[model samples]
Target: MSYQHYRLEELARLVQGELVGQADLCLQGLASLELAEPQHIAFVNADKYVEQAKVSKAGALIVTPELQQQLDTHQNFIVVANPYLAFAILTHVFERKHTQTGIESTAQIHPSAIISESAYIGHYVVVGENCVVGDKTIIQSHSKIDDFVEIGKECFIDSHVTITGEAKIADRVRIHANTVIGSEGFGFAPYQGKWHRIAQLGSVQIGNDVRIGSNCSIDRGALDDTILEHGVIIDNLVQIAHNVKVGANTAIAAKCGIAGSTIIGKNCILAGACGVSGHLSIADNVTLTGMSMVTKSISEPGTYSSGTGALPNAQWKRAVIRFRQLADVPLTQLQKRLDHMQTQIESLESTLKLRK
Candidate 1:
């Protein structure tokens, strides 16, 4: 994607940074230090990468004032308090160029559906009966909004996403491609010798500013709503089971599986590949490290981790043997202590009888 050039002074104003470069110099987009061209801008956050910044071919460099002396030339320095944050700001501006601004005529809208005129529906998209798509929302191609679904304003639903009927999605939400929302939960009962599937009658309620990555599966509740509160960011390939409640601003990384009826608290971070068991309550501000297994409820707000790192085969074998011996060691020590105490007690009793 191509972007129009923004002047150094304008960029500084936009990102709330201090200008140290020639204000008239234009920057089209952001680039890494090694790949930057004369039309691009780059940022250096640490002194360790200052050498790369000096050799970069960027027209402008966003850096801290302390690091400005390391630059090859003073002509392209855009000094800031935080160079990383400045880079994020510039990248966001550059990315906005690729966003769809208006609706396309090729979109398929059901006669019973209501889509705001301000919404942008991309090519070959389908909006089912009685569906309500709000203002400034963008539904990309090959995406399906199933019957009676309500999507709020400024939502971005990427291509090939499937949102089942009766699902409620709020404003500023972003859903990536091929994700299945509001699917039936896994619920079955054993009747005699056969399994009887339970009917899932509940829907999913996704709140504002939520971001769901590609290929994630969020199952609908069995009898109540499966809720994802505002600002929840879920990564790709994650599985969120039925009746799960993920609190506001909680971020769950890729490949995490949350079982049914789990309540994950606000501002929590569940790292990649972590598995959380069902019917548990995890408190706010908790951080579960990568590949950690959560089998119990956590009421405290802190970082909890499990699982061991890789080790050499010989050392690992020794560690496992020692672990097995741990149970025997305590029992042997207790027995020896008990025997010594009994001997001392018998001697005292004999001395007392002789004295009497």
Candidate 2:
């Protein structure tokens, strides 16, 4: 791996962290606490990992103030308010120094395409008719940008990405490899006992600083654009359907499926494996826990969860049986039992009052 050395003091100053270690110690790269080399920097983000940090052979460590105080070893360390955030900053610094730039000679650009001089088009990349690629944007090898697509400045389109016609991607967007944007949405009408396909005539509009992960399929709308607002982050294997509006800064994790015409509010977090049904509106700041199934609108902002926690096989089977039985019980019978209990309580209260 290509490596660059930075002094412990310099690294700490870059992240505005307090340094407690030897200033002159050079760090080559980042590594996990368990596997850190003598030239590498490691981080302890939580208390659980502090033991690992103590045993690590890293040249320097980045740790939260709390963690640093609790660590048993007197070691070279940078004390940051948030170790995870510091690590993230360092990662960006590392990535920028290593990332490739500049256009390749073998890229196929249409005569009508408007590509900025500063944009990088990789080998075997195809830029279609009337497409506009903004300054400093990088379209990686084997990726296809269809006609009339407008990609803004500083965007990174990874290899094998397919951005279909008329899609608008805003500045600083990062789409990972194998992602398919502006694909036809799932729309069909039943007629004469047969399913007739409906044309997806709209496009996709992705806002600034959005990061979409690998292998994601974001479908175009039927008549309006499927929108992802600024700072939205979508994880791998996500399926965002037609006309869906994912509000600003919302984060949807891996394997999440959001159905057509659903409006997910700002700063919402849909955890991994979550599924939202069609036409639902999830309010701002809502958090759906992992594997939760949302079937209707979420009108309030709060953490939501579904499905039982892991259980032993025999216990799980019994729980499943009881769960099915609960659904089978009549609502009328339940209400009658509740009424009887209320009546008994009232009778007891009356007798107590008489005795008093």
Candidate 3:
């Protein structure tokens, strides 16, 4: 990939940072302070990294104005209020150099499929009959888009992704590699002493700007649609069960399992390995800590947590015994206190009557 030079002032404006050094200095790419070359740009967010920034061979560095005074300013500097944020912006600029563009000739697109001319179909991809591939959507290698699937414009379906039949994915959605969408949910009924399979006829409806990470499984609804609202971001190895309705902008971390028919509210954050029970309603803005087992509905927006931390075996045994005894001890103490208070009240009432 050919490196593109960006002016220091242009980079500062792109990241919304104030420029302090020579604005006309050209930065080719971004690199770590220690590894930066003359064509690359580096950043120093803390005093600890200032030494590396000073010795770096990079043409320019992004740093806070306070830290710039401590370092060698021989190389041009872009002074930003937040150097970390500026670094994040420059990372994207450098990463775009490796991005793929246009369709490959070896891509296996079905004749019946309505793929937009602007879409990029990569190698060994299979687009099934009656599918609609939207404008500027890139379907990478080994991806299988099943029949009746609709992918909206500007979406990035990464390599080895599988979108099963009737799945509807909206605009600007990004699905990482090996993620399975619209698979059959776990639904069964006991009929005549045998387990009868319940057909999962409903499809998955994914909203715009949603990002699903690698190896995630989103099961199709059993009877109604399994819906993920706009801007919802899900991490790797997450299992979203049948009929699960996740509200807009809710971010769920890796290894979380949301059971069937659970309605998770908007802007909620479910941390890694958290298990949410079926048919429960989780209120908005609720944050579930890592490894939490949510077995009931959470109506309030406040942070709630359950699960005991690990301790030494001997200490844990003693703690368990005390925990069991607490129920009886509290009642016994309350009864003794109530009896003493009653006796005092009677003596006070008798004295009051005598005085009257």
Best-fitting candidate, measured by lDDT?
2
In terms of TM-score, which candidate is strongest? 2
- Among residues 3 or more apart in sequence or in different chains, the pairs in candidate 2 whose N, CA or C atoms overlap within 3 Å are none
lDDT of each: 0.91, 0.92, 0.89
Cα RMSD of all models vs. native, in order, equals 5.2, 2.2, 4.9
Sorted on TM-score, best first, the list reads 2, 1, 3
lDDT of 2 by residue, 169-210 (tens): 999999999999999999999999999999999999999999
What lDDT score goes with residue 121 in model 3? Answer: 86
User: Residue by residue across 202-226, what tens digits does model 3's lDDT show?
Assistant: 9999999999999999999998999
Can you list the residue pairs that collide in candidate 3? none
Candidate 2: worst 10 consecutive residues by lDDT? 94-103
Candidate 1 local Cα displacement, residue 72, angstroms:
5.7
Estimated TM-score for each candidate: 0.87, 0.92, 0.81
Q: Which residue pairs come into collision in candidate 1?
A: none
- TM-score for model 1? 0.87
Which residue segments of model 3 deviate by more than 4 Å? 32-39, 42-84, 97-105, 310-356
